[model samples]
Target: MSKPRRWLVAIAGAVVAAGLAVPPSAVAQADEPIQDPLPDPVPSSLGLTVAEFAQFPKTELTPPPPDPPPDLRLIRHARINHLGEVPDGSGRLYVPDLNGRVYLVENGTQHIYVDFKAQFPDFFSGRGLGSGSGFVTFHPDFKRNGKFYTVHTENGAGLTKPTTWPSHSANPFLHSIITEWTATDPSADTFSGTRRQVMRIAEARQVHAIQQIDFNPYARKGSRDYGVLYVASGDGGQGATTTEPQQLGNPYGKILRINPTGTNGTGGQFGIPSDNPFVGTPGALGEIYAIGMRDPHRFSWDRATGRMYLGHIGEHRIEAVYDVRAGDNYGWSEREGEFLYKRNDPQCSVYPLPPDDAQYGYDYPVAAFDHNPPPGHPLCSDSGHAISGGFVYRGSIAELRGKYVFTDLVDGRIFYTEASEMRRGRPAAQIHQFQVYANGQRTDFRQLVGDARVDLRFGQDARGELYLVAKANGKVYKVTGIKRFASCAVGHTRVTGSGGADSWSPVTPDKWQFRGDSVILAEAGEARPGPRRPFEYAVLDKGPAFTNARVDTKVRLDTPVEVTNRDVIVVFGYASDTEFYYAHVSTDNTIYPHNGIFAVNNADRLRIDDQWNEVMSRGAPPAITDTAWHDVSVTHCADTGEISVRVDGELLMTAVDHTFGAGRTGFGSFDNIGRARDFRATGTAA
Candidate 1:
């Protein structure tokens, strides 16, 4: 759904809400494995074996604490499109809607201290707000000058009009203008000011509108670098079709670093920094920081590392987070992530690998997922979406230290990666896997007040306090901790032999469930996977001497299936291919599945297959059997539209379905029929 126009302000006020605190610190002690609160339980539609779906070890040591409450709250939620932090650690969040409105949310207030739309009716009165403006940042000396800047998209004539381009063509003439404003009094709480035009660029129909703006923190006051503003513009919104590369003169798809004071400007006008990358480069905009960026929604520097993080929304198959370096070319029209995007395709460029040193030279995404998603896991889906960049946590929240938080605008899922774990030598660095949680459950948190749309942009102040900017509802929400019940450990097991038995014994007191021979020990690995390991499963009858829970057991598949069918239902072990894997149930054979399915289709093969072709011998299958024990879980929740499979703490498959339950539940070859000629189901349950 599209975002709303009005911004809403919903604060906790004086009331305390439930489920709002950080998970207990005990959960992260080295001796104990940290666990996030279990997601609201739901039923599963996919008919999976008890051993197919399991949980994995958390990549992050601990989850971040909930956001703190704001001191002041807005009357109604405001659709806050952009967020900016002042040098003094205060912030101003902006909301520009189609209603010809611009609301400014200042720090320390429950109301918009200044409504630009109300104050500047002549400029904003009738303009149909398109994509909202970038964040509003005060001049470096804003405390003294009360000067601030904003970049917004309005109609060419400041009012809505019919499109002049073909219906098939992307809309052009969407003008994104940057303006400067000065407060009448520096000491006043309200923005009583005179508006001045800084710069305006006509918007092309198909590419990115203006994204965000930031002043270099390192620049000294009144120095040449002062007033040096950085603006992240997209490739004119229509992917690559509506714009061209080497169009250096146009500010369509590049990061423009301009001195806002103009050449003959004053303290309010911007001044260009002499050291800007393109200062002397011919054919380049003198203010350009770096070019070839597409839909760079948010970019920020680490207070500690000075490294910049850019979240670039993908055109088709991937969404990437980039660690930007100075003067680096991030292949856009020529490439997306490591793959080549075909220039001719209106949808996006093709997946051709770029050369090593061309502007087309490929830059690796810190983290990326397939545009198309697997069932049960919605985070992988990108289809025509935007990605919001976030800050590197340098906050008092201990768990968030050195972590970068980002989110997808469509799914509302927040994720984080550890800076310490990023690969230093790779062209594309690895985003060390981490954990995430939903922000809040309030309807206000979900809806944009102005347009009633779901907005999930994240903002941070100088103190590193995080806030959520909602686009659909136009509200700013401070994420704070809510009290929650500690999650219990759950056990997963696979069983073999006629009477083989395996079970999970929880170190902590908890409830348990038996789904065939596999036991779901409520919170089994509470401390560590080891203290409870050396698990025993009784064998009543012998069928196949399957490699039972051994680390790194290579499973060789005789035949190849479609990559899309690489669905596996593993309970306690890892399985990448269709065959040659093992399973484990409870220590006893009480709750293990008798039959389960592991399908290695083209998609599965492509995932594990080093070679792209659909040949079994051409690729290697994942080693599912491990000497070191691990936990796996498969949960089906119909009410919430989720079916999930986890292994050794990592999530593998998650599908969404309306179905509630599948009565039959065992392990080994239930729905999967791939390479079954030599396949045999062995175990007491089978």
Candidate 2:
């Protein structure tokens, strides 16, 4: 397909009617409008103000001030739910919207990666969560092999192999297909990936189609989870009489673990992992990893503890999180979060009814809360509406470092729990609410999307920092302000004054001419890459090799911003120009990845360890190109390997790294014109 036609189909609303095998004529009619089999009702309640939901709970201990300040900033606006990351270092990101489009995000911008809506034009995309395109998972060796997979309901009869079990009926249920893709170039923005259908799953219902697709992160190259792909099989049908969750005859209401590469012992396109709990069982399916779960939609594994955390939606009453164990049964038709469940009762799935431990033997929830109750339990309905699984905090946030951070789908409320305390038998006290804010002020996520359904889903970057996605408004947010170390206290040593001829020395060749009060840096002749940097710069000469110190610079760009050159640059923790970190303030109308803290390896600039995903546009923080002298400061904590950037005396961003220690301070712009006026370097004599 031509690029123009690809973009046109991507922009136009398109959907595939799902079933067995699509007619050849149907592929030609791919641009038709999408109609859902069933429409989902709008969520109840308008919304709550930020103050109403935020809890300023008193605690005896806290992380030292300012790290991970409770604030979130919308980074990308898209209708994407599940997130996929390439193991490559550039932090290349991908997400699939239910509209059947997959987007690749680069430097806070979205590009069309693939359009499944056009490929499978005869697939079902109902108004429910399982509709449209399902999940995407990359191969463990995706970087080298360029292989990946995706799941969506389809009518590709030619693609499906005969099912050993009774797969689908001719009525409301459909066939959900999982397809593999091989990328020509694994790092490209365009979809040069070729598709190959892997498996066709028969669903008894439309809503609980194939939901999850993931390769185990903790599994070593030789371990059981290493090459295995874990898929969540919803009870292929809906309604109370649907007891497929109890009957392991089919892979519904259960977690299916498989080897995508048929090279294993079994004989199929994908082999069943030998270690699967049901592999040797007489009556159970070999692919069944665990049984008895309804809508076990969003679950994650903690790299720190290797514990599987799952957040499942309740029938109408209790929302629960489970510490998933292999072969464990989460009683859906039998019970909801340990409560006695009557499948046919009108209030069967409703909440607040206490559990009857004497009844069924089931794996209960680690934490659960009643959302809406009928008549009896006053304690019910206190928590948020639905569950959206999140990750354990292992990033720079000191206070929330070891806790589990997750949310509710309807109200967008946030909560955390001590990883150790949240066990199988723990009660409601194990869960705790955490106040969320935007730039240190309280803000509600529902309000972020104008009080609509925050169908809240969570994602983490290659750095393990978390991100939130709101499907209603197609928005993405970064949970920022996690401070690692406090500001470096500059002691008695002070080299203060305008960085002019006497105070500055040309680190590279001399593109900087020191005026009396300010240093003017401009391109010298045909600009060539310096030994340390690509542009000319100046360094502070009189220093004691300062270890922990603070340096500030007042920079002014030339009139009529030069769009071709690098932006303002300040280097610190500098052993040499080739071996230091710098604050590459965001540039306007530039193609380079600027406006973030960066490190230097072999004199080339690299991104720092950050709670990242910042959009470096004119709308971003610190408009440095306005020819105004903005105050920029870089603080280094040698003890902690952290660097914090402050623009105009306010905190801009904080990052952690220990590649280089205390050297000297320097300033200049890359192949551009800028003026450095108030250059002050203060610290204890190194």
The lDDT for every candidate, in the order shown, is: 0.43, 0.62
lDDT of 1: 0.43
Question: Model 2, range 1-686, lDDT digits (tens) per residue?
Answer: 11111111111111111122211211222322221111112111111112111111111101112444331221223346766566656577777776577777766666667777668766555334566577777787887888888887654442254543446465434677778888998877777858876667766665666778888666778876787888887776552466667665567778888888774423366788888866755556778777677777788888888888888776656677888867667777666665555666643443322323322345667766556332353322323367777887787756667777778876777776677766664343255544455554334687676755677777777677777777656766777753224345667677754646667677554566776667677653234565335366777776566777788778876735656343777777777657777777755422334666777767567666342433322122433757777888888777666577777765555566777767788787665677777777777666
User: All candidates: CA RMSD in angstroms?
Assistant: 17.4, 23.2
TM-score of every model? Answer: 0.59, 0.57
Give the winner by TM-score: 1
- What's the C-alpha lDDT at position 205 in model 1? 58
Q: How far in Å is the alpha carbon of 180 misplaced in model 2?
A: 1.4
How many clashes show up per model? Answer: 159, 23
Any idea how many clashes model 2 has? Answer: 23
Q: How many angstroms is residue 522 displaced in model 2 relative to the true structure, after the best TM-score fit?
A: 80
On lDDT, the leading prediction is 2
lDDT of 1 at 600: 25
